[model samples]
Target: MTIKEKEEEVIEEFSFFEDWMAKYEYIIDLGKNLNGYPPEQKTPENIIKGCQSQVWLHAYMDGEKLIYKADSDALISKGLISLLVGVLSDQTPADILSNKLKFIEEIGLNEHLSPNRSNGLSSMIKTMKAYAIAFSK
Candidate 1:
């Protein structure tokens, strides 16, 4: 699916939970389901800055598409990256660069996250976009 479609699907999924507690549970579940990351890829270069917990993100191009792999020491941070990876992976660099990722706001993630987590989320997005920029060249 396209990034927008994947994002909309996430938004719809989040809408089912009536409370933040349930939503947080779902996020943790999503984190649990993330594919295993390679130990070798957990280098300092892969670590996202400005996060309270260590978040490692790696990306590679599969032909014209970018595939992302990520892991975090913290549960919520892991889940947050999982959401981004689920939506942005397997997409072209241009597509990743162009999309604004409005679903983050739509799902109330921005409002619900703590200040540190929120900044971490922004760093994740920035790092993802930076990868896109590099790969697009």
Candidate 2:
């Protein structure tokens, strides 16, 4: 699916939850399902800055697409990255760069997250886009 389609899927999934608590639980579950990050790849260079929690993100180009692997010391942060990864992974760099990921606000994630977590989420997006920018060249 296209990035926009994937984002809409996320928005639809979040719409199933009747309350924010349920949505939060869903996010946690999504984190739990994330593919394991290789310990060796969790280097300082992979670490996302400006986050209260330690979030490590590694990206590599596969063919013309960028693939991302990420982990966070905090559960909520992990889930947030997992959400981003699900939407943005295995896509072309141009697509990743152009997409604004409006699903973040559409799903009410921005309002529900703590300020620190919100900043962390932005860092994750920035890191992912940076990877895309590098691969686009």
* Model 1 stretches astray by more than 4 angstroms: none
Assess each prediction's global lDDT (C-alpha) against the native: 0.94, 0.90
Clashes of each: 0, 0
- Most lDDT-accurate candidate: 1
Clashing pairs in 1: none
Assess candidate 2 and give its TM-score to the true structure: 0.96
- The prediction achieving the highest TM-score against the true structure is 1
RMSD of each: 0.7, 0.9
Model 1 residue 58 CA deviation in Å: 0.5
Q: Report the C-alpha lDDT of model 1 over 1-137, residue by residue, as the tens digit.
A: 99989998998999899998999999998888887798999999999999999999999999999999999988889999999999999999999999999999999989989989999999999999999999997
lDDT of 2 by residue, 1-137 (tens): 99999999998998899987898898888778887798999898888999998999998888988999999877878888999999999999999999888999999988888888888889889989999999997
